[model samples]
Target: MKLSNEVKFNYPREDIWKALHDPEILKHAIPGCEGLTLQEDGSYDVSMSLGVAAVKGKYNGKVYMTDIEKPNKYLLEAEGSGSPGHVSMKMDCNLEETEEGCLLKWDCDAEIGGKIAGVGSRALGGIAKFMAKKFFDDIKKQLKKGAYTN
Candidate 1:
């Protein structure tokens, strides 16, 4: 599946970029995130329990940030598996400075297999979108709470 979106933040682009990489901020923002730990290689080990729609599962995954352009863009590659099934995804994120703050544009390509796929693509698409939006919105909230102060 392919998904994309744009989000505007009232904060500076730099702060938004940094906040995206901050483990604490992500854990606080990501819905159902139980843990987010940074690895020595710079990837993040993430654990999440999602209870939304037909995609409910406890997932353990590694998210790698690559092709990074500081304060501008990056790519996220992640793979995870649980009782529901397995998922692998690659997402590209871009940020543009706006007069108000920053404009974040992101797109993702995902492959899902197992029981989750049996739920049908339409339903899964909606669930994916819901989770993604909640994540971005929560990031904004975390930023507002001064989670990304330098």
Candidate 2:
């Protein structure tokens, strides 16, 4: 599946970039996130529980950030598995400074297998979009409240 979207934040691009790299900020920003640990190799080990449509399970994943150009763009590659199925995604994220604040744009390619894939692509796509929106919204709220300090 392919997913793309953009989100605007009321904070500076540098601040947003710092928040994005912070595991504590991400644990709160990500929906259903239970834990996030940054590895020595710069990847993150994540644990999350999610329920979407007919799929519900706890997932353990490793997220790798690559091609980083600091406060500009990067690639996120993740792979996870649970009792329901397995999922892998590669997302390219871009941060653009705007007059008001900043805009975060992302495009993702994802693959799924097992029971979750049986739920149909349309349903899976909708679930993915919803989750992404929630994540961004949480981040925006945290930023507005000065939840992260530089």
| TM-score result, candidate 1 | 0.94
Model 1 scores a C-alpha lDDT of 0.89
Q: Estimate each model's TM-score.
A: 0.94, 0.96
Candidate 2, residues 1-150, lDDT tens digits: the string is: 999999898778998898889898899989899999999999999998987677899999999999999989999999998988999999999999999888999999999998899999999999899999989988888887876534
lDDT of 1 by residue, 1-150 (tens): 999999999988999998899998888888889999999999999998876465578989999999999989999999988888888999999999999999999999999998889888898899889988888889988877777655
Worst-scoring 10-residue span by lDDT in model 1: 48-57
The true-versus-predicted C-alpha distance at residue 20 of model 1, in Å, is: 0.4
The best candidate by TM-score is 2
Worst 10 residues of 2 by lDDT: 141-150
TM-score of 2: 0.96
lDDT of 1 at 125: 95
Poorly placed runs, candidate 2 (over 4 Å): 148-150
Best by lDDT: 2
